[model samples]
Target: MSIEEDRAVQAAQDTVVRETDNGYRVLGSPEESVTHQHDIDRIPQFDVTQEMVSGSGENQEAWLTYGGNYEMHRYTTADVIGPDNVNDLEVEYDISVGSGSSMEGSPVIVPGDPTVMYQSNGPNHIKAIDARNGDVLWSYTYAVPSDVVLCCDDNNRGPAVWQDKVYMTTLDSGVVALNRYTGEEEWYTSTADHERGYSATWAPIVHDGTIYTGSAGGEYGVRGFHTAIDAETGEQKWFTRTCPEEEFVGDSINQAAGTNWMTATYDEERDVLYMPVGNPGPDFDGSVRPGPNRNTCGTLCIDAETGERLWFHQESPHDVWDYDSASPRMLIRDLEFDHRDEVRDTVVNAGKTGWAYSMDAETGQLITRSDPGVQQLNMFSMIPHIDDGRRGTFMPGGMGGCDWHPATYNHETGLVYYKMHNNAQEAWWRFEEFEEGRKYWGGILEDETEAMPDEYNGHISSISAFDPTTGKLVWRDWIDSDTYLWGGTMSTTTGLMFAGTQNGQFIAYDAETGERLWEFDTGDAPLSSSPISWYDPDEGKQYIAIQVGGSGWLRRGKRDDRVVVFSLAE
Candidate 1:
């Protein structure tokens, strides 16, 4: 079939597949054929070496790592568009990449070629686009598995590029490497069995010659682990289970689940990888799973080369609140701690428990924890009347203190900016028989007879800037919306902070004062992915790009997927 004809057929097939209940299925096998429409040899080739990614933010060229750099700072040094003229920023171009349930993946631009970029959609659909004008260069659709069970929506974070290949993890528990130039598959490796509830949704981080990733099935009673695979050959180097054998509460290690569902940060100088591990299985009731749950709900510092654990610090021990330390742990250097009266190197993490923790990079020691970033009522309150069906309300519910959204840090001001939702969620418990390969939440948060509780009303969402070293709030601005602030924040050398709201607006704030500076409506399509910035080498212009469409809470808004790029008006 012709290229256009194939796309038409694929679109029809996608429509039918999306309408199915749950909208995701397991593929027969990894050897299944995928429809391709572009010539592999004819595509342009470019080098995305480790050196390029290491020093990516130093230049005005690319946004390499998922967090813009190995430090996971999410701060870009591009200064072409400053606060003085940011109001002049206007939409440059917008292109839709078909509709999906959610658009959480951030796009990565090729180094020195601002016009070419790559991104993934909700269903693990990968696309290579011309960043100059949002034109599709090539596309690859991953085969969905028919039997996979996903607690959340079908979401793929993004991809990592190294040398000549781009790597992405699929929802079907596999990782596939594609040629950087073309969208053709170079190699596909199964990371876990989807039938056992092991899946991957975060972007893989590549360093040296290895690609590092973690699995996501903390709610399905599957044992979680972090793996390092040979980037070029797709061979397993080493695997470290997030749950240590000694800490297993049950007879089998499978009862412990400490999934690493977020992208990790690397300290190249120290050769340490800081990965945030998710919550344990049987999410609500922890009775079945005993022990301290050592490695789960914590940050694990591993030797990147050997995948050996260097140190770990649990954020929530024996957690019954479902708090997962799954947000990006940002590495900050040479910060003066006013409380300690010394300068120190630290890794900071904003956790779902509503506190920001700063720890020593050399040894996993808690330096300080900031005040609660959100409302914190009924925290750690055990569920009462498991069989009586009595309802309980808790603040900073399962959604987050700061779930999955990447926070931004500013070196000049020594402040980290992150968003928080202050909605009180209803919690209740019931005795449900344990079933393998399925969601094992022992209780339900939202029971029948109430679409949503009246107590959930008047929800407040705010973004706060806090000093990680001293654990003090610098400034904060409350967003006038009831929904969660799902998009990640980005800081610029221009002294501005950018974040998107579920209410279809991209808003900017003054980095120092938290003053609202600018706002642009995104045509009612909620911006769920983090915003990134880059300079167009050909045009000598700087632009901020973000994926818009689909809401954060289970893709509640419009599903029109589009990458919207903005720049100063010419």
Candidate 2:
């Protein structure tokens, strides 16, 4: 069969077997991915070198890492699939991610003799499949202990590849490495004890033979940390506590619960890492955790190799609203602002506070803060106790004006594309003493989705663009839906942005104007994961893929954990 024809043909879903009951409960054997007529050697072997990862922008054939490139720009340069022919894109194949998984991540594509991609499901389950025809190659899993304590819902945000191994962080706090081609376990390193409510939900980024990862469980009042592990030996190279006493504003102990819970952005040129830490413990009852909570609800810039602190900026000082700052920022060089006359290197933070912050990358100083991306209300007022019966209803109820969803940046246009949330919640708090594995939340929230006022009622989210330099809103595409948009946007050089909706719509929008171009309904499941585009040189075809994982809070359709791929119809 012609390479193009083979790629356009939908791969059989049964090409790989999956358990329909519990996600990753029953593991596939080491050689389960090799089909009856499949030859494992058909796929080429190529090293995902450090240089390729750093220069991922130049290599559009694959998505090297989580942020696409170290700069954290999710944009691609693929030109084959674009605005004009996007309408012709059709389903190539759809496969199951097993029964009990919630895929909240994006796939890492590796183009080769037979291009293949690696995907991660909830609680640390991974699978490798042929990118061309969606033939399953291998599967691996690390079942999290039942006694493991969890702060957030169980969700794995995909995996990272370096040299010949694939890396995944587990809900049980294990960072396991697998053979990139064979899916066999090479080594396993536990980052934290799961018995103490510590877990690893964030996908780690591997750089220069070192894998960088951080812990979860800020809600459990655990002291947070980020560690660097040797990719080959699984030895911890460096360890840095996120909230040190000296970094705290008043040397208060309340600053102890900050965790670097999201994937970090790296500046390879300077050998520095930019990471966002989560909110402090007893989230709503801030009276106990006094003084700005220094490193919590903020972004930190540190040395990549040694894990030394460079500079830090606290976004929500004394944050009492559960405003855990987990949004990742882009490290843009030569950024311009309307108020400033000269251009400077800057990091544009799309924070949970619903505002975009442009900061000086060199010093971590605020350059400018743009208008609220969503409705930012009740600015950090003291939370009333639940007994008060005077619950405060506010916009961005813990879910954020921006959540963990990623925003893509277009350096050429200087406009960042983001999926903004317009959510509200009724909240109140109460204090609780620390206990080893128990939650430390000093408050609780009630969803007011039905009582939302007239103005913010129509849509749960909006796809918008902002000029990071001047803190301006260029355009916004409102998505009218009862459910929120869990998916993020990915753009290409062809002047188009692709995004998935919780309602199962895979849409194409004009990058310049936020105009809806084309859309496809991928069954009933929510497309909770982000979409990525890649061009395979041999087949000379560009394709798009996303995971319909549904939300942990609510799901729209029946096909919950499915991988759907699309390409131009033959």
Candidate 3:
């Protein structure tokens, strides 16, 4: 079917039956009740309309929007989970789903409500939970076939909640929006040719009324691009191609390169979206993809409304190693630079090579770069490359100086905290089948070890704290593990940074001092599940909730599939 027809079908099917005041009932969705959302069309469109971007600045309805703040700090303002009462925590509920590859989805708490949403790896199922008692409210499983090319592991990064709708991307190359309250499908659309290497694993970002998401076409014969859809109706507004649209045209061979598998940030005031693209296709070799490979392996700032590429800065141009610059583009204000003159509104991007670059959010200008203080092999080629415009010998081989897990930006102390798994990743060229929906190539190993560690064995499993205002390394705490996988950093108004580690431990660090203040072992290894904090109205206290589940990437000495909550004793 044509894309327009597909949209129309979705629009027609977006109906709901609601209970009325008297007897019969209302045969319409919430949009019929809320006049503003009524004209948004039955089908959802991705472009950020003026309506989506414009809202009452006075509507301080908790963290009701994604990115937490317009900045995407992933931090909370609740003081519920602090050092004083952390010892009085207990498990509210424990439900286990038969496991799969890497569990990388970060669970999100719906504001002013006792609910959280997360997705499971392997199967790519979106699950929502009643945070208060750990009851499954609804589970939406994207019908994923048995055989499909999934890059890392069939993992999901979680979903974006906006205006009573849950926006999610599937591993099967689909961007779908569901009714937030009923879990009914509202609108769904394909991002790329899933039959090839394109998949959607990263969470979707909703800003200024437009839903921003990209595709994971790496290793597949596909090109990368970011698309904007209308949030109310899942309609495609515009798509910005990541790679060169031209190839050997009139010839026998043709190709479209580049894929953005991670989520980007939207600067509403400037009407721009900052995105990071993954490595070039044929993962380990860049010889096939000659030239600087324009937008791959870098951060790009584009006009969110028009999908126009404004400016791009490649971190690993001609990136042969799979050092995808695809981590979250953290937004901050009043950031400091190590050897600079002034503080400014900055966006910090951490990469696989273990360096964090602070850039001017408005102009995409380079501000300063920081090394989180780790050791690794350098990728500098002693022999200069034939002037193809590719620079070699960048520090920290791909496995990452820091990876995809979301970092925390603390407003209280102006610090950004992230987890850095320190290990040497080895890279070499290899031959492989280049099918999209199937495994293409293996990623560079952090070490020569063929198997993940049997114990928590990362060189430095601690959280690295930085002065985002200045891009200076403030402190690094080592957790002593082989690798720290799928976890996120959560900063609270109470001045605490909470993190879940591979060592079956959920730890709390002083936001300013980076001191390990408290910990509780969940009795299992975990990847990508972070601690979420909120205030409980019933008990009139603050609490930290974490999903304790084991992931294949971690040192799986134990298994824990539970939602553990901690609170302070009054």
lDDT leader: 1
For candidate 1, the per-residue lDDT at 158 reads 86
What is the descending lDDT order? 1, 2, 3
Report, for every candidate in turn, its global Cα lDDT versus the true structure: 0.77, 0.75, 0.61
Instruction: Encode model 1's per-residue lDDT on 1-570: one tens digit a residue.
Output: 233444522542363223323224433323343535553443457677778999986756788889989998888887887778888888989877764546888878785444668788766677777777666767777766667767676777788888888888988778899887767788888888888777888889999889999888777778888888999899999988877887875553675778889998989999989999988777777777677778888899999888888899898898767788888999988878876787888999988888999999999899999988877877777765466656666667777788888999976667899887666666666556666776667676642223333444355677899989878888877666545677689989878999988788898888998888899998776778888888876777788999987643332466657889998633
lDDT of 1: 0.77
TM-score of each: 0.93, 0.90, 0.79
Clashes of each: 7, 3, 46
Return whichever of 2 and 3 wins on TM-score.
2
Q: For residues 1-570, what per-residue lDDT tens digits would candidate 2 score against the true structure?
A: 221122111121212223221121212322222212234566578787877787777677889888788887888887877778888888888876554456688888887878888887764567778888877666565645556656556678879999899999977777988888777778889988877778887779998899999978877777788899999999999899887776554533642678888899888778888888888876787767667778888889999978998888888887877787786778888886657796888887777788888889889998887877777566566678988978677777777777777788875577888777777776788876677777777777766534664455556777788888888888887776766677567888888888887777888988888888998888667777888878888877888888886745442333366788887532
Error of 2 at 443 (Å): 1.4
Question: Which of the numbered candidates is closest to the native, going by highest TM-score?
Answer: 1
lDDT of 1 at 270: 90
Error of 2 at 544 (Å): 1.2
- Candidate 3, number of clashes: 46
Q: 279-311, model 3: which lDDT tens digit per residue?
A: 766566555655666677778888888998887
